[model samples]
Target: MRILNLLKIAFKAIVLNKMRTLLTMLGIIIGVASVIAMLAIGEGSKASIRETISAMGSNMVTVRPGADDRGPARGSGGDVQTLIYKDYEKIKEEVSLINYITPVVNGGGQVINGSNNWPSTIYGVNPDYLNIKVVGLQSGSMFTDAEVQSASKVVLLGQTVVDNVFPDEEPVGKMIRFNNIPFKVIGVLEEKGENTFGQDQDDVVIAPYTTVQKRILAIDYLNQIMASAVSEDDASEVVEQVTEILRSQHKLLDSEDDDFTVRSMEELISTFSSTSEMLTILLVAVASISLLIGGIGIMNIMYVSVKERTKEIGLRMAVGGKGSDILMQFLIEAILISITGGLLGVLLGLTATVFIENFLHWPTSVALYSIIVSFAVCAITGIFFGWYPAKKAAALDPITALRYE
Candidate 1:
């Protein structure tokens, strides 16, 4: 039989029962649409998180105090401070992987300017801190390396601090008091928005490590250290080198554990990337269940169609159409229904993704692979679900169908 003739017969049958055909296709439409939308949302969230993490400087590494392994054999308090300026010095001198190193101590207080004060956080670090973090100065200048080493009580304000404290005045060389000790402001940092951890980078102040250590904290030890590797590929090696240096400098043998943790940007990015990708796959997997249900619905309707048209099938078979022809006609009809529904679902899913992305202000990206996968799934479901009905119709006894009431 001619495919067009068979397709015409199929079309006539569907047109005869338009409402049934529409209802049968509803499941496929919903399933395809959900899968596309869910995948788009997942990809968008993953991209957003990655951007947030990158904004903190992709080549950076952070060193923080970890559980002390060598101190007093577990319960003893001999751990003391794990991080100190001497460790920073050794890492800079001995580790070739480290490009820049800086010690940091943080405290929060209300910043006052002519009776207009804003509560903010502060970081005390060396002049190399800006270079290591790739932080740019928006106006004025950063505290010179000379000033940092001299403990010259100089400070740099962030953009947010500038907006609040000296909105109408030039803050260069102006005095801002921290812990009631006045320090001259030498520069302002460029604006950096919120990080993945939800920290406002532009809401804090930066002061020389010497001044912050001796004056504010009044301690010789550092709370944390920030360093940057030459490149992302070298980050792990840099971490290993820094760990060994700190361990050796602190006089911990191989028998004793280290008291510090070193984390690389590549490690963090990979962790977040894997987590995001898995979540996306999981969401898509869950949405695929809807597709399965829809496919089953299609199969159910196809079965009903074959039973209700049994006599018609026998008439066609007796007239000259072979059983194979009958099967092909029915299978093609199912494919047409599914393809139509699948295309519509793709359009609807794209529209919904656009609305969601624009309304919620999240990143949404639709990969071409998703569309191809969706359509392929639709076709597979149609063929798999249509098989039973096609086979049943092909097996119909012409005499029995002809005598049907």
Candidate 2:
């Protein structure tokens, strides 16, 4: 009966001061909403990066020329010429876990079709390149092993090249020049669009590495070796086997460090995930400041509320109201304000996230934990901030309080 009366009194007090209560809760509302929005953006970005890397072939591994030791004796990794065609052949013959392998060489040049030309990257790879990359042809077929052996000047155009260089005409079965070196178009690749790094995946041309090495770059060494494991689970095993084979093929002693760098898609994914997580943590930390400010707002408002109700407290005390009852009454008022504000904040946060994702095209993924945690924090804030003011009201001398103007 006593608790119900205290609750009624608390409810009555809040109803009498609607505007003041709302203004007091504004801090908590903004704080909770900000925290939720920040968390959604963070989680969404992490997922987006993982998905982009996975689409590039989760079972793939890349071997690049370079010593990772960063020693003064070793030049930059991309500039190293340690990876050769023989190293690729040795791995192909020795490693059983990989399902597809290709020796890759790349150069940047303008691809010309009549008067139309676009600056694009040309990737020299064998027939297995498409298989390793997990991409398929939209028209025509990939170059055959015979073409690779003959160093035939045949090319496959990505969607961007087709759009720019052959907008009104079919790209397949046509002649195009790369750096003034004429080539026959064998195929057109499907549209892959931009990746997570914002690089255009479609702005490329692929041909046999032999053609690029002998005729274009005049280089005898391979730029890189790309392979795909039979299964994503086998990627690590494939990496290990390729490393051992390359080391043996190079005739390096056991004590010598590797002259090449090998990395699997799984490793790449893990690295990206870790970095994204750190960024998420940072964003969430910055958003948490709003919650602290909201708590402080609650405390200040409760203090003012106690001061304004001093006469009411004194009259109640004279009318046989217990100090504990007065304390509970004010504390209940604070809690009601906090909880109501929390509910509004949640709705605002969800709406803001949707707006950001749909209108602004920003990534957002609201975690259930974030909402629950924010609400829990709100309740705790109410109790913590409301305590001292309630205590002060309870300790006031009834006679003295009644005499105050």
- Maximum-lDDT candidate: 2
How many Å off is the CA of 331 in candidate 1? 1.7
- CA RMSD of all predictions: 4.8, 5.5
Go through the candidates in order and give each one's C-alpha lDDT. Answer: 0.84, 0.90
Tell me which residue pairs clash in candidate 1. none
- Measured on C-alpha atoms, candidate 1 has an lDDT of 0.84
TM-scores, all models, native as reference:
0.74, 0.69
| Pairs of residues at least 3 apart in sequence or in different chains that clash in candidate 2 | none
User: What is the clash tally of candidate 1?
Assistant: 0
Off by over 4 Å in 2: 1-9, 40-60, 68-101, 105-137, 140-155, 163-167, 173-186, 192-203, 208-222, 228-245, 248-251, 263-286, 310-327, 351-367, 392-405
RMSD of 2: 5.5
Question: Candidate 1's residue-wise lDDT over 1-405, tens digit each?
Answer: 498898998888888889988988888888898889888988888878777766787778888776545456553221346788888888888888778888888777877777767888778888778877778997788887888878888889988888999989888889887767788888999888777677888998899888887887777888888998888788899889988888888888898777787888888888998998998999899879988998898889889999889889989988998898899888887887888779888998899899998898768888778889998999999999988899989988899987876
* Candidate 1 Cα misplacement greater than 4 A, ranges: 1-16, 46-59, 65-86, 89-101, 105-137, 141-154, 172-186, 192-200, 207-222, 228-241, 264-286, 358-369, 398-405
